[model samples]
Target: MRTYWDLCVGFARTGVTGYGGGPSTIPLIEYEAVKKYKWMTEEEFGESLALANTLPGPIATKMAAYVGYKIKGPLGAFVAIMAHIVPSLIGMLGLLGVLYTFKSSAVVKGMINGVAPVVGVMLAVMAYQFFQKGRQGLGSKWMIGMSLFSLCVIEFLNLHPGFVIILFLTSAFVWSTYKESGKTLFTRKQVMRSREEEL
Candidate 1:
């Protein structure tokens, strides 16, 4: 029950407060999932974010569902998603007409413009943290090389991000497998050499 309530409140806070939609809400969601609730470590959350990006649909919803299900199963996922979206739904129902009418007002425009910078800073901070983590895990050279490669494919070649993530994941899996097999073969050769020396 406490878990359910926590899930509700956590996602609800993000729903009510998150401005500029899915991408912008990420930092707030990270706070609840990682810092507030301690549901996942930062590294786990980073991996989850990578996986979530590879899927379709709204990033916020996917993350809410994932965290919810991870903590409390399918019902928790239902609760989390509801809490995450209901506030936005109600606001949309109530404020859509008003916002549309005042969309061109200078005050409204300025308010949005101001918020945009805050959101940009939030995303930049998150990206830098992830960059640091990647550097620690992959080493600076590999991280920078992969970053450049990913940038080229994503920004210049116009390849989809989901495809790029999948490509990297596949490459990592293959490389890991090769390394394990090489170690196994090396151990076998060492064993054979010892046996020959004994003979």
Candidate 2:
């Protein structure tokens, strides 16, 4: 119960201060979910992030659902998801009302302009964090290759990010299975060779 409340508060803070956009908020979310709370490990969070990015809907909400499910099953998921969404919903409604009222206000325009660069900086920081994490997880060769592949697909080929994610996941699953099977076969061959030597 207490854990659930902490998660709610953590997500609420994420919702409140994630000014730039949801993608920009990802580093902060990872920090809270993986580092601060210890709810999940870095690898687990990375896997969840990849899975979330592949699926539709908001990244933040997907995070809330994943974290919620981790902690308290279905009910925890509900609480975390609601906590994350309610603030944004209220803020959007309030902002819409203000925008209508102050449509002609130069001050509002200046304020938005002022925040735009800050948002860009926030997004850059998040990108850097993710890059650092990827480097750590994937090591040098594969990291560079994967990053280059991603750049080519997204920039040159204009492939969807979701498609890329699916490819990555499928490749990882197949490689893991292959490696495991290879190890088992090698072990069996070694045993058979020892028996032949004995004969």
lDDT to native, each model: 0.94, 0.85
TM value for model 1: 0.92
What C-alpha RMSD separates each model from the true structure?
1.6, 2.3
lDDT of 1: 0.94
Residue pairs in candidate 1 whose N, alpha carbon or C atoms collide under 3 angstroms: none
Top lDDT model: 1
TM-score to native of every candidate shown: 0.92, 0.85
| Candidate 2 per-residue C-alpha lDDT over 42-141 given as tens digits, one digit per residue, 9 for 90 to 100 | 7788778877998899898899898989989999888888887789889988899888899789998898889788778777876676788888877878
For candidate 1, write residues 1-199 as lDDT tens digits: 9999999999999999899889889999999999999999998999999889988899999999999999999999999999999988999999999999999999999999989999999999998998899999899999999999999999999998888889998999999999999999999999999999999
Query: Per-residue error at 12 for model 2, in Å?
Result: 1.6
In candidate 1 the C-alpha lDDT for residue 79 amounts to: 96
* Alpha-carbon shift of residue 67 in model 1 (angstroms): 0.7
